[model samples]
Target: MTDGEPIPEERGAPHRGAVWGAAAWSAGVLVLLVALPWAARHRLPDPLATHWGGHDPDGSMSPTGAALFPAGTWLVLVLATAALHRFGRRAATGRARGATGAALAAGGVLLTGAQASIVHANLDHARWQDADPVGTAVAAVVAASALAGLLTWLAARPRGATPAGPRPTPGAPVMAVPPGEQVVWLSRVVNPWLQLTAAVLGVCAMGGLLAPASGLIALNWSLVVPFASTSVIVLACSSVRARVTARGLHLGFGPFGWPARRWSPADLESARAEQRGPAQAGGWGYRINGLGTTVMLRRGTCLVVRNRRGAEFAVSLDDAERGAALLNSLIARSDRTAVTHGDDHR
Candidate 1:
């Protein structure tokens, strides 16, 4: 098989154990979500307080509705993840399972927490309107959900996930490597406008929050929080670094590079450089369009790679031509090494 051809077993099919574990976790969480509130039906109001507006309850539902709503929502999320693992390219690549696990974990925790809070708030209350405030509970649950998601994403990452494919088409650019010499290409790109925008939004969000707390001015937390979130999201995609080496392509996002992507030589089908614009990529920041996922920051020339699944990832950077050429060369070199090793074993 050529390098670009995926192994028979790795053809976008999820591991059975992973599927079972995710299913089990989802079922257990769903049961707990429905059971906890039902178990305390006698203690809770006839129509439990389910939604809060600021410091007071503004929405309520029948005991059964309260118990089933969140459970049903959780069920839908579980099914979505199951479908991803069952039918998408993520099954074999295991690339998105971390995110899927994170969503599942976070959703389960959030829904369970919400249900628990509702039950606790409505306990011993004759009417749903008389239920206690759940503002603090909501805040705590959100924090817990975020923490759980992060932990799950980290834990669910596929281990020892080697690339599975034979070499792709031979037309990809090639760079001859000298014997006993190592070749590496590194490039970094940043959009100052995006960075400045993120900084401005972050500062505004902080000021808005602090002003209200300091008695300087009144600001809605909802607005400030969204601003802060937007700032963070924008900052994360404002800059990117790319490196091509023997290990293949390494891409780092944001300044600290906390979130990164890597592809080994054997995992790639092809690499090339092409001119791309934000319009083509559907605006700035990280974009997923018909052209595939593009990290478009003031796009001009982009280094694009097609992986074994035929998925393309493109990043705007300077000197992209050389980077693409180097990656293709590395892939070719890896293919040659594999052939040599096979002959030796024979």
Candidate 2:
């Protein structure tokens, strides 16, 4: 590397390999899962279905298995594929490798669980359920445990070093900055857990409505409202702007949605980033409380500021410590400028 010479970007082949490998593995797993019940149905006598108390007296697979298994398997496989893409972007390190492996394993287990849930929920409906029920159940448990173990192993591996210094320590107070400098920051709304939960719930609700026993026409409406509302909220937070100027602070999110909130700079006092646990922080989203208002998801850093009225305004940002530092500098400068002008007037 020489001064003025552009450094060559590292190729992404290995990461790509990992991603593709994970995808292939997940696909194979899904295929095996689907094939198992079919094979068992053929091998065992139909009397086993009756013995197992399946809802289907004729030893036929339940509709639930057909629907949920494929859906869940596909969802997990997609997530694993995405994770592999992310993993490939980072330079390979022990930690990165571990994380990648763990993510893949978790994806597999979750995929399996999706299949198992489908089977378990409709066990009563399965005909010719197979003679060795205990053995089959044990195998499923062992497979689940193996998947979990792999994920744990990967998660526990050390992370690769970055050219950048260690990520800002979580919960550290942001350093202050001087006023009059324009600062920009980016935030993303990527909450897998929330999205997954909502999706599963929505799917279940839809399935219930379509089932023969369904009497609650209104149940589907209940499902649609929350599903739609969450989708809107998530979409809105995908991209947002928080600008601090002499006039005031402007906060806007989503491409076309309305701005969530805004406040005058005069009303803004000190700003700091705080690390809050999920339990304390209310699980993600724009949250307000006596201490102040905060926007966060899971466990990450957030920028919190005090208004002139002593109320706090907090926003979740990637690289939150840096954002908080920038905000602090701006507020300190403003305070000093105000004091200097007051002294001169006196």
Candidate 3:
């Protein structure tokens, strides 16, 4: 097996158990949200009214109470977010899972804070009716912080280390490690859940534009629109696959997107591992900053490929040394195979 060549497995469709898991969690969130108003209406009874100002004239809910509602919502969101992280970890690589969880948590906090601020401003100007804006904002912040912390914790869990139903057979070809030639497999680094969430948010933002009172909704749409677009772009790059072969190397981006780019062994320059500090690597994927090209998954090693034209291909692989060895083997095989064919023709 050459280094850049695709490792042969059973040639089955890639496992999508993670997607199913994410879907189940999404359904659970929907069910909970649908039931929340009814379940909490009588029992919780507007924390803002109970703790801050009191009930409104029509008993609808004070401003403070409305603000406090986000706390409860965040609690539910936190649980759902945790579940999403777990599902992502199972479906995606560790770095991707962590990045997705962090992005979701950060995005949620920003959105919640912005909404709370707007509500506070309205209350200050006496433009809106009902509760204590400050109290509500505080409650919302607390809830958002808790949820974010929970997501971070969940994302930090070990990868490919989960206890799935059963393990692969011990001597399976896919499981076997080549002698003296270590292999490094690079999976998609972007989280599908994150991409899906961004798309949903974008759609919601568009929907808000149609509403009569949608000033804030329109603002939200602006924020979410860019995020959705960026996520899609990142997902496209992460899905590209590159494999070393006896004759050459194969490169394809995304699962079903883009044609593969192949390069003959003779066109290759050199393959080596590059190391960088936290500031330079920018936490995984193909990062091209002022420090040059780097593919950082973990902290340590990145596979750097330079072609004859001096173009560089950097991929963040789990095992750097192993991947380097594999590439060397592939190059050697290509040379031998080319020589044998030439001799035979003569």
State which candidate has the highest TM-score: 1
Candidate 3 least-lDDT 10 residues: 158-167
Sorted by TM-score (best first), the order is 1, 2, 3
Error of 2 at 274 (Å): 2.7
What number of backbone clashes does candidate 3 have, counting pairs of residues 3 or more apart or in separate chains? Answer: 15
RMSD of 2: 13.4
| TM-score attained by model 2 | 0.42
Between prediction 2 and prediction 3, the one with superior lDDT is: 2
Model 1 Cα lDDT, one tens digit per residue, 184-229: 6667676767766665675466445433432223579888989889
Please list the residue runs of candidate 2 whose C-alpha ends up more than 4 Å from where it truly belongs after superposition: 1-181, 187-190, 201-223, 230-259, 282-284, 316-318, 335-346
Best-to-worst lDDT order: 1, 2, 3
Q: Each model's RMSD to truth, in Å?
A: 16.7, 13.4, 12.9
> What are the runs in model 1 whose C-alpha is more than 4 Å off?
1-172, 217-220
Candidate 2, residue 302: the lDDT equals 60
lDDT (CA) per prediction: 0.73, 0.48, 0.45
The TM-score obtained by model 3 is: 0.41
Clashes of 2: 14
